[model samples]
Target: MLVYVVDHNGQPLMPTTRGAFVRIALKEGRAKVTRTKPFTIQLLYETTSFTQPLSGGTDPGRTNIGEAVLDAGGEVLYNAHITTRNEEIPDLMAERKAHRQASRRGERKVRQRRAIKNGTITFPLEKERTPRGCEKPIVNKYIRNSEARFVNRKRPANWLTPTTNQLVETHLNAVKDICRLLPVSDWILEINRFAFMRMEDGSILGADFQNGRLKGYPSVNAYIFALQGGCCACCGKPLIEHYHHIVPRHLGGSDGPENIAGLCNECHGKVHTGKLSLDKLGKAKKYAALSVLNQAIPFIYDGLVELFGQEHVHICFGWQTSEQRKRLGLGKTHDADAVCIASLGNGSQPRQIPEPYEIKQFRRHNRAIINNQRERTYKLGKETVAKNRKPRFEQRGHSLESFLKSLSPVWRLDACQVMEVSKSTRYYNSEGRCMPGTVFYRCRRKTPGFIHGDIRRQGPSYGIMPFVCLHIILMQASRRGVMPT
Candidate 1:
């Protein structure tokens, strides 16, 4: 019974008797050992002595000696003086260890090769540097371009050949010559036509040539040339001109020469000012004629105010100015309206509610107050005017009460299963501790009137109580066939 200590690979690191004692000591923490073999164990004792067989026969002295030594309290010395030969043990352990080492080396080599192939393992291009007080080398990696490039060292793929380049240049020069044949205004008109050209035959050149023909007409040429010179067509006034279309595009008029006309700036202004009856031209041509005039005017401010209302026109102008500032890389600061609270009643009491009889009387008073406040604000500083104003809750007038009462008749409906708002609960855990829970709600209504209208705010706010109000109005109106007279 020879004892041996081996590593994961079954390599013997120590011989029998001494190895057993060392193993026990290692287990007891009195000694320590490391092995690449799979086995780790402790032995109770080690000695060399003879033992009799159960059949009453004496065993071989050498074979029984190992067991006898283990049975005794005396420690067996695995010294050079006492040697036992076991040729296979060393050979077997050596073979196993070699096989395992080869396997590990092969695995490591495969990983390294893979890394190199994938470019993960790359040689550093930058020089190594050490910190001011440190001796360690600091490795740095090289940065490369992210864009894809061809492997060829010659010109880029999209670069034109010398022959193609010459051909393009020749064609471009020809086009320029043809463009020069036309006046500047005609050139602009041709370009506009080219920009908006639509294909009839689903062919590119056909559409472009067709549009060019239309733009090159004598009538169009005369109109555009006169327009470019800023001469009014109605009176031949050189002050300014407006391009008025005979048939308005919005009313289904084409961009044909026969559909276009010109007007004096004054006449155009009068038309939009409602002094002239545009209805005389028919609704179809009215908008188209207006559009043409708008385009011809040089002053954008006046033209925009004429088209959209003053409020919307101002907003558009503000947006345009903002965009221009951004393009020029300039910052803008605008003063915003400030919010202030004013108390109308005494600090102790709620605001008074006007009686039914006093409603008409208070109406006059309220209008007067509002008018005075406006006038005062115009005369005084903003801060002073705000300080002077008071916030008063007005009584609900008969009209307002009637409006509320009308709403009471409308029914409120819960979301149907098909369009219900779904909710989910979630629990979180971190670092072996349970965290707080949370609930998430998702609304799934897609159609209009799923919610009420009057109280409903459009857009994102439509999903709340306002939605319910809107839905009620829609349902009630549909049921009663009540036109909103």
Candidate 2:
């Protein structure tokens, strides 16, 4: 394990695993421990500072983000995989809302005595029409009594869902921390954009070329044409190049890059006239999830440039990083991909990948009870706390000696004597009623589930995967270190 160090001013220094150097510094009182979790320390005495050019690579995902920093020599320095709580946030929020609603329902009682003092005789009444088409007075028992919502709301411009915002924030914060800890001169973000279905068909239109939902492309067309080596796609001829839709427009085919291709007029005519088939043209299916994440590219780019300066940050497609990892024969992982991105400018030198420490964003358990958490019931019908229960005991009042005293001078005291309970002395509540030595009987009381120690386990029919259904199988597989073979 390497111990992270910082200068007197808290600026980061290269990590060191040299035990003697650290021990000497601590023994000489030159350094003081700063953080125990990561075992980091800061130098108390001034020290000369030296840092090398480093690049930061970030592999952002929906659930986990991988970060890695590499020096100019292509050495892995820092590696971490931060698991985010994107999905949990919403669930927590829902729980909080329920708690708040319970609070509004007047569940929490203060000091017990306060409840007695403030108990209301009746709820406020509201007049309303009844289902029988008659106006009648009714209690307004449904009052939220908390806060009134506006009842109408609108989403603000550039709005992002809570989960997405959290994800973006996680990525930004992870990147920011790395920048602060390392002398990051360049930032390489591996953002892979897939054409998905369009690319698989090989007929997709170029950005600068004529297109429909696929916008016009300037240099993107050059890349597409380069793929064909300036030769017509349909006819091997190098003359009279024209873009044509493989599938007819009336058939719901789009002008997407995968649906259009470079072809000679003769081939284009033949394709439109149904003399040629797109399937015969080698079209294949490609699956890619292209959505909000792709749009986040510009947003993330702007953020990086603002933090690291536009000149220091560079963008590389995810495929490029994947290719680098394949060439280096590195294991497939988020951290390995990050290393690939950082090594994009490192040339062809063989570099070792760093081991990543996983950081789980687990929900810390709160000792406080969740509000309005009702007990689960086997069979239910308005189960409530039964009040006015009479205590049952086999013996009369406390002890026989106390009962003897209550008698004679009170052989048979007035049956009108009511039990007077006082605060427990060395015991719980004790009343001077039940007139000593009177026989008692046993009465059974059923405690609510909330106070019970245990209950019978549910049968196998209940299953063990209630929560598991919420997880996407593919995502769970990825998290389990499994490759989709």
Give the runs in model 1 whose Cα sits over 4 Å from its true position: 1-211, 214-240, 244-260, 278-485
RMSD each, Å: 45.1, 22.6
Residues 1-485, model 1: lDDT tens digits: 33344433332233344655665677786533442221233223343322211100000111010000111121221101111122123333455556666655545565666766677754664546554444466653332212222333478654543323332333223223222211111000000111223323345564465565446447664755454465654456765455666455544555554455456778788766877544434223223323322232223233334433354321213333344335434333220000000000001111221111100000111222222221111112222212112232552222223323433343212111122212222222223221122111223366565232322212344343323233445456567553221
Candidate 2: segments with Cα more than 4 A from true spot: 36-38, 93-157, 194-292, 295-298, 345-350, 365-485
**TM-score of model 1 (CA atoms):** 0.18
> How do the predictions measure up, each by TM-score?
0.18, 0.50
Q: What tens-digit string does per-residue lDDT give for candidate 2 at 89-125?
A: 5556666666676655544232233534566422332
Residue 214 displacement (Å), model 1: 4.9
